[model samples]
Target: MSPQWFVVYCKSREESRAQRNLENQGVYSFFPKIHKERILRGKKKVVEEALFPSYLFVNISQKDEKFSAIRSTRGINSFVKFGMSIATIPDQQVKQLEQLCHVNNKLAINSDDAYKNGDKVEILSGPFKGITAIFDIEDGLERSMLLLKILNQDNNISFKNSALKKAES
Candidate 1:
């Protein structure tokens, strides 16, 4: 039988250590991490943290007794099991997870502080290109409201945050 993915529970804050031990034992494993932007000491920084705290994934063949020593591996508490059966992860799901994490691993939360109320901005690349507007409150993560002047009337337009840039000076 071929090796299949399984979840390994680790001691608190020991996911990286467990992954290292598994690698040293020539066992395949994955410890997915994500980059999070945070404010520390009044400064913004990006920190890499385990996507799944106290947990990592390993590939093992259930029928291979020779690999049974994994339970005694350092930093690993035990394998995640349901009732009397160990949970097995499908290769497709693992691959898909790998791809998904790879694409979105670096996430920016409250990272950009470029906008402020009444700041003059220009629509960089959109149907409103070259149009000047006032930056308003951020509507959400990807959306913001801009105050634009059209026909001598103040009009509010909602657009993506990426669509606006500080108007020269």
Candidate 2:
């Protein structure tokens, strides 16, 4: 039987391990990761962290009660869904996300990020890498100042001498 892709719940910040768990159990899973350079205690470090938190996609047969066994494992919740039905993940959305990751170098949300005049602007690495930032500057592309919001808090992510572009409006 062809495996259908389903969303699996994971422990907060445990997405990488959760993917490994499913793989060890002979389940095909997708948990995209990004390698980034981080600073820890005034030291620079390279780390691999899950692109998505508390969620991973699994390719498995939608068998009766099989998910029960899956849900019992560590760092899992349940599939994302609507009332009385599990929401079907769109193939296009997945494709677009992958493309966005490659094009710019970061994950952009499925929200309207199209910016306007005087909007805070910051260039990430490539296209759409501005924390989904949007703005217009005289020399935006030459020097970009991005505000990186980490840990659910607003913080400045300034990137100078970057190639900046107007956020899609």
- The candidate that wins on lDDT is 1
lDDT of 1 by residue, 143-163 (tens): 788999999999888989888
Cα lDDT of candidate 1 equals 0.83
TM-scores for candidates 1 onward, in order: 0.67, 0.52
Worst lDDT run of 10 residues, candidate 2, spans 134-143
lDDT of 2 by residue, 1-169 (tens): 4556778778798777777777777776777666565667654445666677677877676673455577776677778777877655666676676675565434332225434446655454654464555343322323434454577775544445445555444
Model 1 steric clash pairs: none
Screening candidate 2 with a backbone cut-off below 3 angstroms (N, C-alpha, C), the clashing residue pairs are: 141-164, 146-157, 147-157, 148-157
Give the per-residue Cα lDDT of candidate 1 at 125.
Answer: 79
